[model samples]
Target: MADRILTEEEKAAQERRGAAGGAQRGGPPHMRLGQPTEKSQNFGPSARRLLGLMAPDKVLVWAAMAFALVSVALTALGPKILGRATDLIFSGLFSKQIPANVTQEQAVEGMRAQGETKLADMLAAMEHIRPGQGVDFTAVRNVLLLALALYAVSSLLSWTQARIIVRVVNTAVYRLRRDVQAKLGRLPLSYFDSQPRGELLSRVTNDIDNIAQSLQQTLSQLLTSALTVIAMLAMMFYVSPLLAIIALVTIPISIGITAFIGKRSQVKFVQQWKSTGEVNSIVEESFTGHELVKVFGRRDEVGARFQAVNEELRDATFGAQFISGLIMPMMMFVGNLNYVIIAVVGGLRVASGSMSIGDVQAFIQYSRQFTQPLTQVASMANLMQSGVASAERVFEVLDAPEQTPDPAHPETLVDPHGRVSFEDVSFSYTPDRPLIEHLNLCVEPGQTVAIVGPTGAGKTTLVNLIMRFYEVDGGRITLDGKDITDLTRDNLRSQIGMVLQDTWLFGGTIRDNIAYGRPDASEEDILEAARATYVDRFVHSLPEGYDTVLDSEAGNISAGEKQLLTIARAFISDPALLILDEATSSVDTRTELLVQQAMANLRQDRTSFVIAHRLSTIRDADLILVMEDGRIVEQGSHAELLERGGAFARLYAAQFAGALTEDAEAGQGAVPRGVPVH
Candidate 1:
């Protein structure tokens, strides 16, 4: 099972359940789910790498930033412009109250004589005022219109900046996803053998998505927020330096709170994602192996495990959100406090004649704008942290070591005869445990070779080596006298076809499934292969015939029918070499006979290797090799091995002993050669 090619469902389960981890880290076996395997240990490097991915789109980034700057600048000037209209209203009202014949100087003198010193001072400070004039409605309307225009243009630029940022973020994320996918292909199979599948899936799917969302939401807002803060500060100082200094007092306090909370929440965010991956793994495994859990009556155990992991996720998420959630309210507190102080001080300054009422009002607005961005920055801290955490996982995939590359100039097979040779082959899954050592074998152009062995006897490993799924640790494997390593992996594998015990059919029509073996094959060829494998016999009975859509599990088809479809798929490839690994294990006696007939036709001119536990299927093979542990113990013709009564004979006898007894009691002298092993 471990040596077989993993189906999508199996890969999801086995990848994270790698046997390399001797002891689990997070909790009991079920709760562990390979937790913390994907957690980020370093934040800075990962963040820098993530930023580096955007280097290709720096032009767009700079453009967005520039637009944000101009937008913030224009927006900051709006309040000041409106302040002029405020001055106009005040001055117009006072001017209308005065007599038409009186001059501005006369009005001030009259107010002072009346003991209205503050009012006299305020009136004296007013500009462009005439004693006989009424309110200037036209001038006030012009100022209001100018202020509105500035706001409208500023909003337009802000929207443009957001659109530019959206493009930049999505492009960067798309490239990141592509690179991660390519990285997965380059990594060695052993890497998957050791890592959890669910964790990698999370990194590929969930983590990348989080990073995309974080960048999309934060990039534009943070850029604008920072610019707004700078622009507002300048406006505040321009209106009144004293009020600006008071607003600056809240900066240190806000920074202190953000830094303190951000640090704590960062750790919790890592745990939160880690637990999320674990939960995903448990659910994936439970659903993939749902039938097994029920057959074993372990549904309660699986449910309990899911609940425990879910609780862990809940706790981690709560801690992260609660701690980071403090930023907004705390920042709001400091902002409101700054607002109150600015209002009070600006009022005093206005009364002292150091500032006009209009200036005080504008300065108060500037103060609010200044602190609003600080509050926004504080609130965005959590999103940034979570995104960086997800980035770390993605970077880990990009940073993983890749498999050995193919030769710059590869060899090719000329008129290939399917001759294969193993020259002193040495291989193992681990360094400390050697499975196959100094092995050598050769097969002719067209010979059917059968291998029989007990479990863990390295039966599947031999075929895996031929496919170069794992490179030989030492020595060389050759095809037609050429070292297999000299050829590209694809070039070497193109000549071979294999059908395993566990049949894999994707979600597609029966014809589509068969065509998967040779994508370029025509419809006639697909139909011919199906007919040859007995798939046509039952497929025609279906409502859609060969066009029937198979679900993910292909549950509409029986196990034997699925097995026939896989054989048909293999048959369509029409390769020079074929491998059948316990291919008949899933079929009943009648179906097995049909499968055997199809295989016989498929194996006619190809050099075939058959790995089987039921010795009866391989009795007519040209050569039979009996194996024990990792070594071939004997090789001979089937009848010769039975006559020798050695390892092969013992295995054969054990499988058919009951059948032999029944035949003897039924008045038959001997068991027939083709009796089913089971």
Candidate 2:
């Protein structure tokens, strides 16, 4: 069975299992759903390319940086300004009361005569310029107002900065998603066949979403953290070089601890996402094939398998999150330790009068600011790693080679005779192993060609070649004396109609589906096609008749009805060539007979190639080819092939030995008795 993608319910269940908070490293929820693993990818290339994605928004980036600079500058200066306020309060409120007009000697004598000896002594030490008596409320108010203004302006600029950054990120990812979508159209069918649908979906949805989220969250933090660290360090140095140097010691220590913890987490991050994808794959498979699983009584086995993957996911997520989670707390510990050290040393300096109390306070604040960003930077490392990994995946799709080019000068067939000829055609699914070799065939207009073969005998592959789903490896296939390769694939395909064993009816009303092959078909044309294929019999039975909507899987319709719908679709197209591979396999004998009659009528003037394992279906075919492995072992009419007693005769006997005996008992000669030519 073709691998199907996860359904909405399964995907929703996976999401419910994600961490209540979010994925580690700011990746998608899928990343958080898997178990911890050991893998790492170098993000240098993706990172450079990510920056290239942002290259278009250079002006906005510069604007954001400018705003960040202003915000950081104002924020960094806050401590120093607060120190000034402290100095103003200290100088204004605590000075001894003495008149500026009175000399110290006179003040001292007056105080002594009033019997205030402490004041008299303080006055004796006072200089000619007397201390003020009242607080400097006006000066203090101005300083406070200026500090408040700086903060207000800083906040405004920061908001503006955030808006611009958001714009830049949104635009970058918009372009990225657009490129990925465009790349999808350019990619070949082989790419889709080689990759899982869910995996491709994840690349387009989950991975791209993760990249956008990582950018919005981490990019903002990254820019702000960088500025905060720089501003803090500068202020620390300006306050006291000794304290600044002392605080710098914590940088290497914090970084070493973070790097040690973060590196291990980063390695697990890639593994985490991969395991998550694996689990999702299992869920998708089980959900899509739940019916088969239940019918085969494999529910317990499938459940056990799901439980094992879930356990793996839980373990990996715990390991990655547990390791990465230690970053901030450990850095906080180092920061607190550094804070204590600075406080003790600065206290000594203050005691020695080398630094003021206010400077020491500001320095301590600066130390906290400095270490805080160091911690943040270490955390951003994880997010950056995952984002870059996601970018690499998206880029891989975008970078895939495009489909083979169409011919510059294409050939066309006019008044076509529906003649299909395969001349020395050769093809192999793999390059080293040759499958079909120098195969030759000729089909006349309005002839029914039957191809009967065992499993793995390249039945579908041969038909695929004629449809140009795959090109012939060695020789050319021609239609009406013109090489198919010389014609544009689109033009060649327009002339052929196909109905496969697996009926596909997309989500739409009954009429809409029948008209899918010929969008411009009128209602009358659709009704006639439906009647021809016996689709209208059941379609009219529905409550909504032709207006009834089909589900995505089209399960609302019976398998037989679905098959009839597809046949009707092919009939509506009314192409010159018809290819049917077990087209009536889904229906009962009665419906199959009806469909066969309909198909016979449809094939009246068109060349038809019928692929069948049932000998009854192709008994009256104009020409029958019995294939073994990849070569046709027998080719003849029904009576001729039976008379030869070759592979065709053997296969026919295997399917209807009793019928053949009955025919001979009835004196019917060598012709098969199960089915007769009409």
Candidate 3:
């Protein structure tokens, strides 16, 4: 089958989709970052996993459920007891409180006419009561006292449920976080390299917090709502099945209305957020590039676009909110329609002597209870989805494939001479899209070897292989005749040291940052490392000396000084092999000279690999390797390569020729001082 060419728009959309997937791995924060994850849960699976989290502590979960059931049941019972009190008060008024000659309504009207405080109180007591043969204050008082007790018991049980569930939620979240942290250590470096830190951070912090809060707050409400619905329906049926069916009619109608409105509102919400984000981007660009806009004479165009975006955003926001807001009132209207039907029909039943007024009152309260929970659940559906999404994100980390396993019987390097070799190793960031292939190299013990190339020539990739940051797809790498993969990563890495271009320093004292690799390092050991790396000079220059704290950015210190601190950190580790990738790339010539001298001293008795863009630093290496496309194009000392007039010779001429020419013109220096720092 012939593959059809994609349209430009289709191709662009595919690229955007790819970018979005990449963003989830690691990306810059969007204003409403949570919005995507909130709606992104595999709802069915995540909800099952969430419930499963509670299953381990079955005792607490069951206890909480039991208490929740009791609380809601008592709450349901309260309305029925209240209806009985109304009946009792009416009976008492008709029999004992009202004048024999007066109608019940007339007595109430007379009391209002007199406006006597005591008489008004007597009238109010029998306002809904009807005349009866006798009244029983004893039974009424007993019923009221029982209600008070049930209410108290309900409150206590509800509080107990809250207390227990909160503990369970806390414990679950704690374990979840612990599992994530442990999983991070086991994850392959490729996972982190491909993904963004923001995604992981959100999972670790925001997502977990959402799950915890939702479980604590939503779960209790969800349980109570469920029980309330059940109890209300049961009470309604017992009072009268005909009215219960009428109340039941409202359920599907309310749900249907909610689902319809909810679906439309969700669409509007997505559009609104998209429009809002566009507006934000426009506003941000307007301010950030104000000077450019003015220079280009496009202020009016910018203003016109901003107005259009703002108008669209306003329309969407209003539309979404209006539709979502309709749920409550539409539900209320349906409820009221049900209420009017129940009251009218029950009154007729009472007149027919088939039902009592108290039962009608009780049934009305039961109907409210039934509808209230449905309304609450409808409102909470979004929150539940948001919570489930968070759980899935957290679980994603826990479920990621870990690093490749070490050999069952691993080899060990007893006295590592740091003789490193790569034999026909192959690997790629993407499958079949080879970044490095069939590459081979070797370094002798105590040899200072330099690998230099243009950007993307696989110099750093080679170093990464030597350090085993990623496992090679084929062939092997070895240290002192032992296969690197046959040894555990910790053991392999313990023998190697690396200084990368990017300097990472956390928030801590300068001393702490320097001693990060060896926390138990003695002051003497730290000072020795610092003095060797020329970090002592800067540390002492600060008023706080070594105690000076570095911020997360480490902006208080110069970039060169921060780089030196990292060199000191590596020095403190005292590994058998060293890999320096642009170690002095950030420093000035003078500072670079100082670092070179320190590095020269450090590499005296250890095998070292240096990856440099600058040719001047590594001319004196025992061997020089020129790399292109993951293969060595030339291998020799400086003189040999210059004589051969190959890739390395051309590279050398392009970079250091001016320095050598300048030195020659001054008649004070020659050969670009290529050999040693001092």
Q: Over the stretch 1-678, how does candidate 2's per-residue lDDT look in tens digits?
A: 111222122233344543231221223332221222244445556677887898988999998999999999998998888767765565444344656566557766887899977655543533222355545667778878988989899889888998898999999999999999988865655555544455567778877898998899888778888999999999999999989999999988987997788767766666666556656666776788799989999899878877886787788677777788888788889989999999999877765547666678888888988888887877676677677766766777776777666789998865777999999999865576677899999999999989887766777667778877667889899999899988987788888888877788889899998998889999999999988888878877898999999999998888888888888888998888888888887779987887788788778899998988887788779999887767888888877887777777777767776766787898985655433322
Query: Which portions of model 2 show Cα errors greater than 4 Å?
Result: 1-38, 93-130, 188-190, 380-382, 399-403, 407-418, 480-488, 657-678
- lDDT of each model, Cα atoms only? 0.83, 0.76, 0.75
Alpha-carbon TM-score of each model against the true structure: 0.90, 0.82, 0.80
Clashes by residue pair, model 2: 34-313, 35-313, 35-316, 36-316
Clashes of each: 2, 4, 4
Ranking by TM-score: 1, 2, 3
As for lDDT, the candidate ahead, 1 or 3, is 1
Query: Which candidate order results from sorting by lDDT in descending order?
Result: 1, 2, 3
Residues 1-678 of candidate 3 have per-residue lDDT tens digits of: 000112222233334643564232222232123223324344567688987887778899999999999998898888789778867866675566565666766766776688754444444444345444456778789889988998899999999998898898888888887878888877765565434344456567767887888787788888888888999999889889998987788888987997787766655554554455456556655776699989999899889878987898799778867777777778878878988998899877655546656778888888878888887777665556446656766776777778888788888876799998988888765564576788778888999889888766777777777767677999899899888999987788878777776677899999998888678899999999999989988788898999998888898998788878878888898878988877788888888888788788778789998887888788789999898866789998977887777888778777866776688799957763333212
Model 1: weakest 10-residue lDDT segment is 22-31
Better of 2 and 3 by TM-score: 2
Note each model's CA RMSD in angstroms. Answer: 4.1, 7.8, 8.8
After aligning candidate 1 to the native by TM-score, how far in Å is the CA of 645 from where it should be?
3.7
- Relative to the true structure, candidate 1 has a C-alpha RMSD (angstroms) of 4.1
